[model samples]
Target: MRRRVLNGEICKRAACREHDMHWKTLERILTFTEPPGYRLSQPRGSKVDPFLPIIKEILESDKKVHRKQRHTAQRIFERLRDEHGYNCGLTIVADAVQRLRQQNKEVFLPLSHPAGEAQVDFGFADVLLNGELTKVALFVMTLPLSDAICIQGFPRECTESFQEGHVRAFEFFGGVPTRISYDNSKVAVGKIVGNREREVTKEFLRLKSHYLYEDHFCLVRRPNEKGHVERLLDFARRSFLVPIPRVESLEELNEELLRCCTKDLRRRLRGKSVPKQELLNEEQQRFLSIPEEQFEAKRLQTVHANSLSLIRFDRNSYSVPIFQSLQDTASASMRSR
Candidate 1:
């Protein structure tokens, strides 16, 4: 309005009529270069101000209790009225709670995913395998820096399958990541000793020894530490396995998954200039070279045959062949217990 009036495009009366403002307001707008911001003469005080300290203490104490047992706005209002003799409306208490909670909200730093670092996780998807709708476990590995991903389907998520997934992922990536993050799955961690300490399984140790890559296990129930793979697991399921794939075998399904991963490498992500493949190529330069010898993706265990010629493994019983004699393998006088 001021620009039009001052620039002689329109008269002040016409400008006021066009802007639907009173002549005084129009004159004020013309007088000043810009509208001054509003100011309160005096800040308003709330009835709940006297009980704010007690409210803060209650909210602080609520943090130590179970989330389900925490105080709601109504409960806090009742406490303020009954316990502290606070005679304020529920709206005020609720508003105060919301404001305090917002002030006390947790803040997280942005994660920096350096090159040659990856995260591993598992997801599940339903697929038609051999004409049967089967739920398959998907082993997902993602290079966080590159946003490159590799996925393979397995019949079950066992230690053998877990090891095999790493083997195939390393082969697909053309090199092993220098550092890899994983959840505390039994396949890798035999036992968690303490914070950041793990008693890794023998097979897991063997795999790491062969690849020469450092292992990082996430904290108990803390999946966000390796959130890259966790999110990509869902991405793989939705983008690659959507509409429920139909394949004759797990091998066939894996081929399709590999193709999808390769094709996805051509896509340029939001904040990146180059395609994911270029980033992956750069990341591979920092990766550990593949070992000369291959790592076996299986577990070895020795079990004795029982009196009924049965051997027990993984909570299931398997019968020993009738033709094979335990006597020969066992000590001459020892019983086959």
Candidate 2:
């Protein structure tokens, strides 16, 4: 074909069209008198090739060290140059290190959360409160099976916020989840008894008892057990709290969050044929009924009003009735009232 194209008997286009060969290949073929024998290309050597064992050893040892103390690509490159007399660009070392680390990276198994099960968590974001930029804690409750979420903002994350968050979430969801997963937050967990057992806080116990929902606390330092809500917290902050919502109070901010959560029900998530609301409706059928009794969420403490008609609670002072001043009025100490 090359000879035919070159001999002028046939045009290069015609020869290439008939032979189904590329123009560049025909041109190369025409440069040789006959077909060249096949030759194998030799592999090229790399400056870091000799130090691969050392690099692997360093990476292996890194597994036992603190993650922040692990050697970065730049540090590895510097060590190779200084200690092993390596002469290579940082790009090569970085590429090699990244590839090796990818090979050794941890993998996670796919998880499935059942209907009527939920995960709870808290995150913080900046919101405009009364025209001032204020940081607030966001309480998030997510139904992992349906990907439904309920978010509310609070002045702070405390027992009050935690319990109130659950109450609001249950009301918003129209039912209580059969089981709820949580981290070992101090508001919920009084002590870590063992690998799995927990000494739950009194407030948490009261809330759970009122709601009649099973509570599962994740293992200490292992947030991945309830990773669904963990991821949703970031999503909620970025999606719902972005642009720094301007509100008059935490109540107003919570109202806005409720609207956002309600609007999100219309979204059709990936791999789902129906909107989130439909999935939530189906999940609600499996959920426990919301109790008819209203739950009082507060902390109780015994205190005596001082001579100045003041009582201290949670590091702050409040005025009591003057008649109760200088008296050990335990009733006045009930913040729940």
Candidate 3:
């Protein structure tokens, strides 16, 4: 059929002539001209576009929300109809949302942490806190760029321990990092619903607000997201905890850890011209200043009142206000050492 057509034949191929291929499509195939690259402009007077900005905002905010909690395109269309007086079809909203999601993923770039940025994580180790060999959770924070680190020990990995670790670590550096990266530890995160979005614990939130430092969390199981602290945890187990110094209390041992961390800065890291400590010293100036009033990191424990309106906690009797009943304050809790 091609030979006859090229030879000036009448080309009586009814099957080919009956096809729906347009002249532009045929021209591109025959002459090898490139097809038009741009999409056709949206027609004027289209109501679908007036609601696009609203849809984009909703989708952008949805990235922080749990997948299950997110509104479906149908739900969004309904919201627009009810709230924004939108009169578009469900397909329009769905298609727009799908396309926006694709564009968002394509445009996303890996973020870089500046000098006053750090990563934090926790690990468990055995130590003699008070002449008795005990296992304790250790908090590790790292300046990833300089590779300087701070490690502190705690009896447990609760919010109090977490808050203490940050305060002491910032004091150890004489300043606080502008932003700290962390894993989804319960001390820092109340709930991890979807992707990078999280519901931070109340105490951690208070601590963050108090310090005025931004906090970022790694995705679950992806330690490489906070690789510095992950590496610091292993390094602490090997180098810092070696020969286990027996201190009088956890406090003394944490102080020693800070000294050791400072000593570590004397060593140079890979691809660095100067010692790690020198780099850390220069960067510390950029860190945010410590607050005048420190955050009180405490656990809120609920205690019930007895017949005499006295609440017993830790084998100690404390008088509750006679006006407040136990039943009335069943949901109340407090922080105690």
Best by lDDT: 1
Task: Give the CA lDDT, 0 to 100, for residue 14 in model 3.
Answer: 41
Model 2 agreement with the true structure over 123-197: per-residue lDDT tens digits: 999988888889999899999988989999888999998999999999999999999999989999999989989
| Candidate 1 displacement at residue 115 in angstroms | 1.1
Summarize candidate 3's per-residue lDDT along 1-337 as a digit string, tens digits. Answer: 3345456563434425756555554444444335556545774465678888998889888879888998788888899999999875888778887887788774434556689999888899888767888888898888877788889999878777888888888887779899899888777788898998999977788888898988888889877778768878899789988887788888888888888888888898778899987888889889999989967768676888888979887468999777656545664543321
| Alpha-carbon runs more than 4 Å astray in model 3 | 1-112, 306-337
lDDT of each prediction vs. the true structure? 0.91, 0.89, 0.80
RMSD of 1: 8.8
**Whole-model lDDT for model 1 versus the true structure?**
0.91
Which candidate tops TM-score?
A: 1
Give lDDT: candidate 2, residue 12. Answer: 79
Error of 3 at 318 (Å): 8.4
- Rank all candidate structures by their TM-score, best first, as comma-separated numbers: 1, 2, 3
C-alpha lDDT of candidate 3 relative to the true structure? 0.80
